[model samples]
Target: MTQTPPEDAPTDAQSTFSGTREVDPRYALDEASLGVWLTANVEGYAGPLTVRQFKGGQSNPTYELSTPGRTYVLRRKPPGTLLPSAHAVDREFTVISALHAQGYPVAKPWALCTDDGVIGSMFYVMDKVEGRVLWDLKLPGMAPAERRAVYNAQVDTLAALHRFDPAAIGLGDYGKPGNYFERQVGRWTKQYRASEIDPIPAMDRLIDFLPATLPPEGPTRIVHGDFRLDNMILAPDQAQVRAVLDWELSTLGDPLADFSYLLIAWAIPGSLRNGLAGADLKALGIPSVEEVVARYSEKTGAPAPSNLDWLFAYNLFRLAAICQGIAGRVRDGTAASPQAKSMAAQVPALAEGAWSFAKKAGA
Candidate 1:
């Protein structure tokens, strides 16, 4: 049984997650100090800089830095305690710097500040990509044809990403190559346990079941752990992707894991996490799951997974674990967003959904 969004879930995702807001007081930084650093570190930077925080990004606190010359975006590790190996802005900078050189749709890398004294945490800045960041999966105002084009662009971009040879691009050692699923299961399970607030039997059951059912390892590629509609910037007047944002969870791993995670939008409901479970694809002009898979196959020449149930289960559990980490942050006074509590509240339902998929896969 797929989980539906809660009644209190924000119905208008575009309104909720789109655009920028005044910096949250908790995540505020010293604008004068940052401007000074940018002048010294980032080439071609001049100030009279004004900063406003972006409303999106749950893991890293991002800001829009406006200057007389150009605009830049900053991503930083959240202040105070953090989960191990989480919020690697340096890694984000490295990957984007590498990919941008290859003409990938990612922001141009500017500079990375490792000295915590400048901002109380490590941070990096990049070109502020100019485009639309659509939050609503239904794409409310888009024409049906435009919606179809956007969906096609989305699949095309992902396939292009998967086709990149990490070694050829100087990312050969980005992450461990083989035993991707087994390692991921262990990693998330450990993180979940570290962040556990209350006992979730479903998560525990998954921890036990997933390792035993590990699928055959596939060729490793760069995996964007949270690739989804919201993570992309689209051209203002076109269906093309201008840039892909938020590289905090990217690493060398199974490309299928990345694709399967994107497929979750078709499985989960909009109310829960802005998913498309009950969406009318024909009317909306959005591609069906089969159409999406077929298009990906056409682009990548890889066969669709014969069984995605296990993959869905693993992805849901991974998401639940991530949200649980947020819950732990809320408890420890390190949560970055005002919506962290609401996100934390979904952990139980996500765990249950994962368990349902596990059962479907004969857990």
Candidate 2:
């Protein structure tokens, strides 16, 4: 019999951005236009630029910008019709800029371009952080001790983020305070309806069940809406996180809710695509989901919430909705990555997972 992967294991594909492919034609930027914009807006920019798209992200079209002196990363909104407030590149720039200014491990902000005439969509440029971006939650190819350290570092970073005062950091208005779960559930529900293609009964159940089971409001902090191991760039030789990438979904929300969302990776099994559910965690020496939560609570000095299971179910519901949206985009020819179809294919399984946890909420 195979030992199961711990329920709290992080889940992401093991990959690198080193082998960036030619820019997808639909999302391509005119180098001349981009060069002109950079020259005008970005400082110290002298460029005969080369551009290639990174392979990892599922939402935004991320590209590597090469200049004679240095390389930068460009994140742009996907071209085509979009649902309201979906691809908010401007918001991404704002959150990352604010965090970087306060010595947070985020990519250094360079400039934000809103003139759609230049790139066909809103976009931003930031320093290209050089580090190991381990896509696999298991930290494949690493020693067990190194894997443990990496996981600890990830949790520590998350705690540090929650501990910061968003107001003092100029992010007080980043998102509405309080009732975050309510707002998020409403938002994703609308998004799901807008992009609905297939009928998912579990998703329907969640849309109805979540509101009826609302927990007491928790404290708000700036939540990295899509926090996970792959969303961070780790130090090349050590377990330290160099920069947290992808702020497209960052906002003010219940910190425990955000942390609970991270814990979903553990609930996902390794047998499933983009899941780590069935891997052998004991041999890998990865901590269980319970241990990870305990560590976070200890580090942040916040007790775990009484309705923690409910929050987990809510997060699972949100993720399934997100994947459903991706499926819609794929069907409509607006998906950013080719892998969107595969990701979308997992929506039913995700919905079932959400329903399973929802049932367990009161047990």
Candidate 3:
């Protein structure tokens, strides 16, 4: 159920590379139909409409809708045949709708339309959020202390999500109950094979090795499959996360997987395009990886996972598979971004990096 983003933003990373591009013809909307539909269903809808696609979000095609009165954001599944369970606009709508209902920091969901005839695909509309979506891991433009607050806010938000009970929020059945990593490994493995271009030995090794050495499943909370700086929407003038955007990969699963996924930035070398692996943590005023984990543990009152190495390698491998799927979409001409090929090229390096971690863990 994965489709990679078009640009080079982190796979699970949602915030990045601001500004919109001309919508690809393949995913363009029927504006007349969309306007008519909105006029009838959405409250306070206004006349002539214009649409431009957001540059980020790989799996779902997101657009900004402008009318005379206000602006709205539309997220839709891309056109053409999709990988199994990929581009799930419905699931995204479900999770976001529930979260919004509870006054969570999500873009307020307006409506979801499943009839493809309206826009040629299932889509949902939400209030357009005006905020800074920081793309850089280094968090340029911010003072060191501000960078620290940004990271701390991110950590606190993640812990808060983990501490909430899914059942209490009406998401108990959001995903399968047990064996999240097992199911995810098998799922990503299938997704990778579906989009496989050329065989990478490291990917092959991870597919074979991860299952045999799965870590113990911790608590099953609402896991944001992709929870990193870019995936979040920060306040326009502050370091706090205004809204947690992109629910395409979110589901009920091990919260540690979500937390550890954020920590992967520390392991990735600064030589890599979109990671903080080898950056100067103290100079940047960003918390060290250890600090991130410790803060999450302290906030949630749960110690960091004992087998973090396994979780880190697993999350990296999953991200690599996600990138490979984007490559496949590019080859098929169904990709949403022009940067798909360059992003796909990073797959081999990502897989190799994951394998290095696995080797360290003796998996």
Best lDDT among the predictions, by candidate number: 1
**Per-residue lDDT tens digits of candidate 3, residues 217-263?**
77889988888777788887787777888888889998988888888
Question: On a 0 to 100 scale, what is the lDDT of residue 338 in model 1?
Answer: 71
Judging by lDDT, tell me the better candidate of 1 and 3: 1
All candidates in order of lDDT, best leading: 1, 3, 2
Residue range 90-131, candidate 2, lDDT tens digits: 998999988888888999999999989998989999999998
TM-score of 2: 0.94
Q: For residues 280-306, could you state the per-residue lDDT of candidate 1 as single tens digits?
A: 889999999999999998999999986
Q: Against the hidden true structure, what lDDT does model 2 obtain?
A: 0.81
Q: State in Å the error of residue 286, model 1.
A: 0.8
Pairs in steric clash, model 2: 7-266, 8-266, 9-266, 268-277, 269-276, 269-277, 270-276, 270-277, 270-278
Alpha-carbon runs more than 4 Å astray in model 1: 1-7, 270-273
Query: TM-score per candidate, in order?
Result: 0.97, 0.94, 0.95
Best candidate, TM-score: 1
